[model samples]
Target: MKKVLMGMAIASSLATMMFVPNQAQAAVEANIGATSNYLWRGVSQSADSASVSGGIDYSDDSGFYAGTWVGSLGDGNGAETDFYLGFGGESGDFGYDVGYILYHYADLDDGDFGEVYFNGSYADFSFGVAYTVNSQVDDGSLFDTGDIYYSVGYGFEVAKEYSVGLTYGYYDFDAGSDSDYGHLQVDISKGDFTFSVSRADEDSGDDDTKFVVSWGTTF
Candidate 1:
């Protein structure tokens, strides 16, 4: 499952750090959160239900970071677990990150997959892309790999401890899957709470506009 992989990834990150003693800054953190609706690329993963999640992350002064997250899906597939590791750093006003992430569904058949991603930001604008690579499913309809996701975002602080963010994303599915779609999301956050609204360009199939309320904290 994804949770299992995340645990493995965390352990691997720690092991790798052991060999680079001078570069290891050693910082571990944890996070917890709840969301009114769990949405992924404009689709509801929780069937429009609320879900809770928790995760731990390890980061060094250098740019290496690894983390895991597990959240209830509320659908028949049960919980979705994820693991990711990447390097990120800032240069003046620009920042960049490159990483690999794995998503696992413990109870769903052929639902485990992984992707390599790259993201960059300059000031308040950001762009990113992710490509699917390894997939556990072997069926003809693999439903994985060859899919790419592209996103552009802008964020700005409206006031102290308050911010607004807008993102537009497009998913390029593998050939023969006409399910490709694009979505735009707006989020307003203050402290630990956030309000988000999103709509997909496609009007057909579960593309209904969604409004979600969420809260999260890190320590």
Candidate 2:
């Protein structure tokens, strides 16, 4: 499964390169940061611990972009690396993004997956859907493929350089019981540095709530 997804990713990249014009004019940017906890789809990825991450991104004037990011995930999971490519543009007050992302886990067998997503935003509100294209396990198997996630978020400025955001998401497994969760976040920015505090709700179990504080900067 990993081999097949890697091949498709390469083919897609090649196709983009063949059609995109003036690729050399693209803008490149890099960022590094640390998070109190690595969370994905409202679930913890770092065993409820802190994580350091970094990534570089390239964006063209034609709304095509690609990037790779990596985050540390302890508990013998090593690192989680993600490769993504997408195109996004705005139309009047609405914006749309479509993309594919592959999640790879270092030092872990049968732990890679791929997803395709589409997102749209109107003003300060956004909504999106993502579907699992393939998983580490073979296709056509329950819980391995055909899973879907839906999310909605809204953000607004509370004061100068301060903002608050709320998000809710639902994960519907193809084989297991569904899960739903929400997140609330507050952010403050000073120059290139941003501080954030976030709280997320767990879908099940006794530890139903989790909070994290983090600081990050971009260069």
Candidate 3:
């Protein structure tokens, strides 16, 4: 299962690279950051492990965007890597996002697949949802268990170079799944540095707390 996830991550990254939007008036940007734990849709991608993550992105003045991101993770059960491609746009105070992400790992089964996501933001609050599709498990049983995830967040400026945000997320899985996930997190930013902490709930495990400290700059 783990190896399969890793393969999906690689394939998704390559797919994004092979396909670029035909556009004019687009501006390119890049950013990189690190965190003690990598969390996705409220699940611990790094488990209790520490990791680093970064990505580069491009956007058009008319509101189209695409980007790739990578990360490293460890969760005791297996080591993990992630690659993702995302597109989004902003119109006035509202914005929307659509993207695909692949999860991969070594010492595990291998295959490629991804999740489709969409979300929108307005003012200090934003919300979004996602679905995991066609993921296969090592046992020859496809993780027919798909996922639906949603989140909401609010941000406030604290200083000339600092801001803070609070977010909440919920996840629901397909049948026979006793385990689900959710999280409430707070993030702080100063200049190009951002730090965050989240209290997570996993259906099958004790509630976990995760922390992230990162530095990023836009160019």
Candidate 4:
């Protein structure tokens, strides 16, 4: 049932991106990267190990966009594939984004879900909210609809081609335990290549503080 809904959502987004005649000037982009650990929302997704990731995106001048991302998830977790569609535009000094994202775990049966999110940013500061709409895990025992996450972030340039960022997030679950976490990151870019170091603080369950390094490029 959940899988069916997931398929429908992806199909709908794809159709919209492909058939939307107004987006005739759409541009395509691709990115690839490697990370020492795959951390998602402050939780380790790659069992604290390294992973490879990549994605492709389509965007137009009208603020509509769609993309697909994939990452290797070490050991028994298999791979993670994400599909998202959104529209983002600037208003004065603020930018807003609204979108739906589906996370599909290949070879990890019952470990898939979807979320709808709204994000706003001004200058170097940002805030966002996400709500889980569906979960495929063990009949939604591990993750269920209505789970919400709130986040705030800030970033600043420290030097030429270097920057620092901070992020904090709180997860409120409808079925499971809740958690609060924070992340500090530093990034350096040279041409098309970027290097990053990120540290996360865990505030609940067995999640622990950890650090990760990564390198990536976009084309």
lDDT string, candidate 2, 32-63, tens digits: 76767665655556776777878878888788
Off by over 4 Å in 4: 1-25, 176-206
Candidate 1 C-alpha lDDT tens digits along 26-57 = 78888888888776666566767888888888
Q: Which stretches of candidate 1 lie over 4 Å from their true place?
A: 1-24, 138-143, 202-204
How does each model score on TM-score?
Answer: 0.85, 0.78, 0.74, 0.79
Q: Pairs clashing in candidate 2?
A: none
Clashes of 1: 0
Best by lDDT: 1
Instruction: Show how many residue pairs clash in every candidate, following the order shown.
Output: 0, 0, 9, 0
What shift in Å separates residue 119 of candidate 1 from its native position after superposition?
Answer: 0.6
Model 3 lDDT tens row, 65-138: 66666667564444444555566666688867677766555545444446777767788777777677756554
- Which residue pairs collide, candidate 4? none
Best by TM-score: 1
From the highest TM-score down, the ranking of the candidates is 1, 4, 2, 3
Whole-model lDDT for model 4 versus the true structure? 0.63
Assess each prediction's global lDDT (C-alpha) against the native: 0.69, 0.60, 0.57, 0.63
When 1 and 4 are scored with TM-score, the better candidate is 1
Per-residue error for 181 in candidate 4, Å, reads 5.8
lDDT, residue 6, candidate 1: 18
